[model samples]
Target: MKAEHQNLYQPHKGGTLCKMLFPVLLLTLFFPLGHAQSSMSPEFSIIKPRHSRLLKSALQRETSAFLLSDPWAPLENQGWRSCVESRNGPALPEKSEGYIQVFLDGGLNQQRMGICDAVAVAKILNATLVIPYLEVNPVWKDSSSFEDIYDVDHFIDVLKDDVSIVKELPEEYSWSTREYYATAIRDNRIKVAPVHASANWYLENVLPVLRSYGVAAISPFSHRLSFDNLPMDIQRLRCKVNFQALTFVPHIRTLGDALISRLRYPQDPLKVTAAGDKEMAGKFVVLHLRFDKDMAAHSACDFGGGKAEKLALAKYRQVIWQGRVLNSQFTDEELRSLGRCPMTPEEVGLLLAALGFDNSTRLYLASHKVYGGEARISTLRELFPLMEDKKNLASSEERSQIKGKASLLAAVDYYVGMHSDIFISASPGNMHNAMVGHRTYLNLKTIKPSMALMGQLFLNKNISWSDFQQSVVEGHQNRQGQIRLRKPKQSIYTYPAPDCMCQA
Candidate 1:
């Protein structure tokens, strides 16, 4: 049997198959020859693929007998209700000697994470946050303004008690840009910036700036705050910041409501009768297919589309992403097997299908204009033909309103993902990390990838589809949006646990 087809599992030492199987087989001797031969055919064969020793045992977990969902069914735990009930943020102090205010400026994901940090910093310093300046992502050239996407008025009103916030810098723009101190941008192997200073540094250095200049401007503030050994209250403030403060703007939200309504009744009787479709489809999974051009160029993976493609990606990676990677350091084969970069569409398709998602399963792909367009998408589409995107789901008129606005389109995907039945990501990228916090805050099911384990399995060509699927299924069965109470700063899956979950 081909490795890609069989249900064989890699041999983990001291095989756990029941010894009684042989004895049961003895009874089969009395049966018809046809029945016994059934096991000999390809379908029931137990042969492990060649060249495979057990890579770590696939995530070993028992099947859950009871459903772990709430009464609302798929809307099991929404953030609106779940978060409002959280005591995750510390009680507000009665008095403050002065206020620490900051201006946030970064790319979309950076700004999202920066909001979490800014709220934490505000609580840590007991400062009020000026409405952040949402900078256009230079790389993306998106034109949507912050107010156009998020409700600034609602954002301030909701968090007014926990931390004071204003829309835009309260004073002249020069006050923010001129008399401010900015933290040095930091980076590490994982792209998560390391802590630049201790709490004392904020108290002594950053605080004085607030005192000296009523407003302090913190550029590239995402991932700037560290959770290392901080006081419990400080950590809680971080959660409060992430869950409570960063509400979407009203414009994006109305569209979100429409999307949610569609999900709730995909086959409305009235609409269906008009459109010639009555089949109801609900509960989709979101794939943050982070394989757009920028990502591929940034990673420099170059999965070899002949000589020209390889050289182009190699050169592209060199141009941006700083000096984090170099083409000469790794080969095409090494890059693919090492899992050092994003998975190819074919690879993702194979992975999803092998893990039991039927080809007919509806996958809501949350992505921008994928780099290679339909050609790249067709790779995964062939495997899961029922795939849909914003283009497929929304009307031409609906899409035209946000046409050419990259950030608004992203907002569409973000909101849809937040409400999905299950959210699965390709890697620990921004989309995955942000949703981990967002969905986790809502107690929604998230299939967080264990990259190291996945890489080991993905690279092992000898593993059969059945074995690969079973291992993946068992490995991840326990991680159905289970709370990650405490984890390292770099680990994106548990990123929200510090702020979103309580002891209850």
Candidate 2:
């Protein structure tokens, strides 16, 4: 009975040899099946791009051991220091040296403007510029890494000999996460460079690339992160070569140029105009409490405080009304309750009425309805409690001019171009600020900074609305001499605007 169970292999062969041979045959037959069924995890398998040679060393047996065991281990290269050493001087004879590129990763949609200020700075420095779009692919089920989004070889090919690409990781602690994308870039398989996250990352990744290539300094923006505090490196680099920081402002250049072009051609309904002395109908000051619903996530760089709703009435008052304010949740009554001096709707109404063009002045309250900004209609009611009675202020007909977010922002480029005054912007990150500032600068009009600090903390040292007001007046006066007063460096005027269609 036991003999009947085995049969085939043990029936007539050498027992030990048959056992070994059978096991080998079974393994051979099932090996492909096991491999076919196996799958990589979502994070790694998804978004897998075509093979990259650079990626070889990153995942190879020995290098991967180092990566897993000691990601921070120093490589045998001079690091970013060499590249920094190369950029010092007067424009590098335009063609004498290679190109350096600073890549802004995860730059999707309107957020691409963050790189605007930086890109404008780049053109001034003569660096070859490239912006790889990291768009997510819907068809691919797996998570797409940065490698899948951008063509690395194509990116490198565009660069001049000595230059390298530096990825600007989004801020730490802020919810805007771009670390995964940056990691993919660093994980180029071949271990040719160091992978990094910040200036320190640059020292690890960029420095190694340059050192290996025997080049010096990458053309980057202000080296404050790398050498500003460390005088020794700066001094050492200073002696070696022109280790200077170059500003790239292409983003700014394009936006500014687009605004200027539209102004130059009025027939284009899609274009924006410069701020004019005459206010347009519904010329309201639009402030953002929350940029869409994700306000809590992306801290307000323009709102002054980290959170928008918590901004004190005092801080709110600091934003002088250049035009009619569609009502914010921060009403005059609320301001008074908070022990902050309040500006009445009558006062706001009076300012609008007194305006050289009241009927033409349109106020807009733009924010997601969920964020709790008073509706434009109700806001108008508060601004003119007696809209039902003209004796108190402007006639009801006059107050009906304000618009809401959808309508207002749709034609923001227009209002900003034709009628807006120094649009008291909330922050640079907002779509409003990008369009308004870009358009304002294109017309060569004086575009001033927001009264609100870059973040709430930016107001800490400069607290007290009184002091803040004084600073606003004083700062503008100072900048007038710089950004506004100068002969307008044509260099500063050439940033590109975002495709207006995207704004649509």
Candidate 3:
């Protein structure tokens, strides 16, 4: 059986022709070609020609007993409501102190948090905010600006009452650029703002700069503001920015709506009656597969890729971080026991199967490139044959606007994930953190996976499928969309219970 599995994947070496035949061969091996075609929906049936499908039928048969009668039932939200109350907080000052400029660095979600913190910092210092600058992402090499991904006008208009915001600096402060600050440390440049700096820290360090030069430019400003000890109004303003202010541009939203429409009604329009349309409006689960190469390499845990894979990852780690991976000291077993390893595509597929999702579930994959390419994700495709992603669902013309732009693509995924009936991330990261908070704010259902429990379960090679399914179901009982109140030093973006929510 192992040899057959290895043989099934050998087409990847033969290039395009063999890639096209790979899925056909797998379909023939598992189900007859006609049966495969008839069983698949229009969307799944017409995935890119080169896309491959490989299934291990023995594993599927083992876990088929746990399939639920109603796996699409919505998770409840215990009467919690999103409420940003600043009635007792102080009002905005009549006159702004000066201008505050921030250059944010990181991916979409990290920069998103930085943007909110920039707004709060502006409010704290009573300064007018110049639009935060989004640095070019090093990994994706995307040069998309803030306006390219978000609705700038909407962002400005939504926060107009809370804090002052401007698209550009005034003529007097126009000379303040990122290059200017990098060349030399001017009086107005703040290059040393601490991570999670307190409001008082900003007042002392930045307010003086603002008063001295009438402006302050903060570079590398991701996570520069603290989450704790802020005033009630400041915290509420952060919540408002995250939940109400940030909206995607028109094109991204249009594409997102189109994708959502297709996911709900995948059949051809000519075959549909009104009743059939109602019945076919299916609910989808958006699985944010955060299993890219950077994550896999940085985890420093072996993924059964053999010695060559291990050597490649080690070299990658050295090149990326100069071999500073802190988890490298631990053995793979120790790391898995500590829940520090990233889950692979196959592992996450088994997780979904154990959680009662069957082959019929419409799984929308919200991800970038998986590490090992098509061969790596073959098991996941087999587990949920009805799965779809941006590339498969959107036409080349339809997705042209966001094709190579990572930030824009992420924004589209964010929009679609927001509209999904249920959202889950294979492993927790920035995207997962952002979605969990946003879904909680909207009272939508989101499954937070227990990484430690899952790690331990997969380690037990002799465990039965029934026992694994029961453990997963029991472990996740209280984790689905439950409100976790913010503790000291906890991010309001992730745990927005008392700060951003009100109990009914």
Candidate 4:
């Protein structure tokens, strides 16, 4: 195993050891080796043999007698409440302008945002919306449509007053399909809709098409709508779509409920109990561990996986993105300082430890296959032995419905995440963004980690565990479930304040 590990790190023929050492030496010149690892507490040290130098140095730190506080304590919501004021919005037009179709791309969350935008766009155009087409995710290869994941009847029924949504196109427009638009760019197909496009842009571009053909189909409709400058009603409608209209199919919800039940009451493994059974139930924290291989490679940050991991990620980047990753230009230390790097499983585990979460904490690992697999998450598992995920909590037969389907699996996680007593993401991504906004609307406790502070703290070799804990607590004081009003051009989906919330 040692020989294999060494062989994995060996460079091509004629490459000297100095070549590999040069980058490390260069990094040390700016940021010394002393700043790399000593910052972590000894209690959270990883036990892996071939770990990062940062974890290796953690083993050398003096043990501190720090006790876990009641980390499961509920947080107070400052005077704001979720009040989506759509009552004052303009009433939907009795007569529709035409049919509006959107072919949404990306993962479940991205498509979810698109669905909200499509509804908003339909209202903007006074057009009837055909159920938005969910493009097969290229990465997950999931061909699940909108109906497959969401309760379509509920979706239409909830949004009936806000916008007109249909199950499919009219028979007259049956010829208007995804393939029809792909074969040749018809004038009716608005394919060039820019990212975060203003309402006026859609009126100028799409209204004419609706007038001409009685229908318009927008392909690649992910993030094509603007987050700002829209009417208040439009913004509120978007929120309604996200928070109320979009609900998982019955099976996904059932699975999610089952997982939540198991998390709250772990003693009865064979028998899933009701969520209301509080006698033996415990609160669980949903940790959306977003550290996947694609995210790791795209971030272009070193994760202490050594040279072999680096080489493998580089190859992956080349194959997938043609080496066009922008973060590749910066050093790992620079990225960490800027908070551009994704927190590793070990680092996030340490964060949980520093924030008072201990071995007794019930942690739900909400993620797909983590970048390095089980070996990568072994340290985290060691930290929280009672951790659970979909596979572990649900039987293989229970998981069969969502098996091999990324969107359905993600929907399950999303459902479970929404019901978690507390939610914290290892790093920010689509799922994190969705959960943050949804939890905020419901005024639930959601911890948004201060990445820059965490990076700086982690980089400090001399900082003790107590100091680290204080800094973390102080830095995150204002970040927990606080209603941050949406700034100009900021995502309403992520920050649902002022638009989706009303002062109490």
Candidate 5:
């Protein structure tokens, strides 16, 4: 598994300048209008003729700022809404002989986010209508603007059968997965392409489609795209579009709250819990260790070749496990799995005394080969007499997978969550756990620019896992030392039934 970096901000030199200026402009324009509204609801007075003109200018500026700030906000006071409502549905330009439409399949990620990115390019370039998946049903229903929307019911057939808009796609774009998504873009006469096409391949094959649709430039953030490889002609087209006259001067609206608002689902119960758990809700640091068994995708960067890959995985696993043991307060259940064997009985006795366990921290055994089929349970029972109880031995074996990969990972996560007091994760494979959860410590080896941006965004959310750990280590150290396991908030699971107590 490759290291994953989180990408929060789309890369744009111009966009960065726009972000810095927008807030100041909004603040300057908003204050007076808000004061006037509070002072007089329906009407207000301007002391002088010059003041009246200045007031009108302020109001116009305010309206523009509000529209940009919140596209979803009501635009009744904003003259732009009325302007749009009044304009007759403009006919498609003669040059717009074809179209390039996109439909997102799943939740926001590289794919949907990339498409959203195209919004800026399309607006600036006067490209053919590039509607986002969310905007299919326009919020304001005006006929002229609404005519651009085509019903997607027969979208697949249209892509496969339509000849007017599409041309043959590249061979690599003909894979089954590509065709599956291409169903939406294909025209009867032309073959629509997939997002997976390399930047160069897309520019070569899709430029004609853009020109046919009168689309000079497009935003394509939803895919792994780069302008570095575009053909010289396509670059010239973009330059031309940048200089072309605009029917409407482009305006970008930025809302800091928009992303958070989108995260709230309509069906969400919106539950909030009291701060502390019944028992010391032991901080379970999740360390995800992703070992890619498949050897197919390593042709490009084989510095040490296959030998390097194996070494990387082993080192990664060892580092994560050692970090967890050193940083966290672990129970006997966890220490037994650490594989740090004592050289002698005296050494083992000292280790047990240090742990405050009565010769019960099972001495790590060298002969044990749980990764292969060995009597790990029998070995454990012999080492720790407390496990002589048949029921106890059976339970231990059931909880710990001494052999298989899937089961081992599951057991590790479970044991940490159940018994540890702090957690740190190193895996980039399980995106939800690594990216979305309340993570406190992360052990990522690579620091891509996109990932750095994501880390900044992740910190904005107060409940992230890393934040939780920081609060505990800094503010709650005294509290943890005195902490005792409270009664389980819910019941623990038995052998035949799986545990539901840990469900998030």
Candidate 6:
């Protein structure tokens, strides 16, 4: 067996298993028992988490048999098709109003969300958006401009009806830039927002000021525009900006698209016909493996690692994550129970195995180099021997195109994941959120593990592979492609689901 990943298991995540024992349906239709795991397969012996009340009703949640009703369910009232068709609105006048200047920078996900907010704000304020400035992180200080990574002309053309966009300020303002400019808030050199500003907030608070001053210079300029009770038009416009307007630079897009085609239609007929390899023919899963040093530390999951690994990750966290370790109120144990940590690669391997994916199942891992390198991924490699990443899959010439280009490389990951048949995220980070919204926007399925159930089932030493597969398939039948709804309304800004996502 692989090194024990005991740390990945929390202190019984689900509430107390209901005292009244109930029998579960033993058979699963989709995955037959005869086709299940061989008895010779790896058997993991785990020290089961002591049952806590949080994981109650585990044995009897589903009282009766149920079949999958719809493979693709939708969010009601999002009306994306209607909204995109009805996008004609009064934009800012050509010669009259001031400008809404936004600076977009960060890793790919942050910048992607920023672009949406900037476009939505421009629509709200009825001000022309000066070509939003794009900044690269100093970590990977590639001197790539916005146009270098994205098709600037395509952006302007796609959003022509939504708002007037310009690469730079007009000649008049270029000469007297400081004189014509006004910042988002009263402070000349500062930006202010007490909360994730609402579209109405922009319309009411910022628009009048833009009209008065003819230019609003917003710094850190884009993020967290609201989605809740705001006008439907604003929500729809956000979707358009995210899915339609922003596109990768031509060459990078071409590479990603070519990769997509290959995955969708592998040339080898044997790959299509082979028992385990049939899953590779099209729609391979993209595992956004987030086991990087920074992510693990921020999650406070002190999973197996030596003192050097711990210290290295801790120190790295202090430098990158807001210049300090995230001082969460919860303890590491508590965090694990809450599913706050990324699943260990071993845990993920077991998960896919339980889901019936085998060694030959094609899995494109969209990630940075796995932390702890090959040793850490050893267990996962045993389960998924054919897993591929950019390093393994790309040709030397293709690798050169994305080498040293972090943003463009991230774009490639995004496109590949976006087109995959299933996208399984290690954690719900920016990559997951961004891709989930886009995939949801396109009415596609994304399989998110129900950790609550997994935490319970994995504990039972007597649980067979067939029973586990039955539980997972039945549990998640409707979960895939389900219209995501915001639970607590405040989370919409960060999550932007159902709001940023719409059913056509």
Q: Highest TM-score among the candidates is held by which one?
A: 4
Give the TM-score (vs. native) of candidate 3: 0.86
Please provide, for model 6 over 246-327, each residue's C-alpha lDDT reduced to its tens digit, 9 standing for 90 to 100: 8888888778866766655656422333577655556477888877755666766565665555554554443334224554
TM-score of each: 0.72, 0.32, 0.86, 0.86, 0.23, 0.73
- The worst-scoring run of ten residues by lDDT in candidate 4 lies at 35-44
User: Which residue segments of model 4 deviate by more than 4 Å?
Assistant: 1-69, 269-276
Clashes of 6: 10
Ranking by TM-score: 4, 3, 6, 1, 2, 5
Q: What C-alpha lDDT does candidate 2 achieve relative to the native structure?
A: 0.29
Give the poorly placed runs of model 5, Cα more than 4 Å off: 1-208, 211-223, 227-272, 275-282, 295-504
Q: Candidate 3: where is the Cα deviation over 4 Å?
A: 1-69, 268-280
Q: Order the candidates by lDDT, highest first — what do you get?
A: 4, 3, 6, 1, 2, 5
Per-candidate local distance difference test: 0.58, 0.29, 0.80, 0.81, 0.26, 0.62
The parts of candidate 2 lying over 4 Å away from their true place are 1-130, 135-205, 210-357, 363-370, 373-377, 380-422, 426-504
Candidate 5 lDDT: 0.26
| Best-matching candidate per lDDT | 4
Give the per-residue lDDT digits (tens) of candidate 5, residues 152-245.
Answer: 2222223222112222233533331334444564322223344434444544665565655333222222443333343333322222221121
In the range 78-128, model 2's lDDT, one tens digit per residue, is 111222222343332344122233333222213233233223223333333
Candidate 4 vs candidate 5: which has greater lDDT? Answer: 4
Model 6, position 362, has a per-residue lDDT of: 75
Local error of candidate 2 at residue 269 (angstroms): 7.2
Instruction: Evaluate model 2: give its TM-score.
Output: 0.32
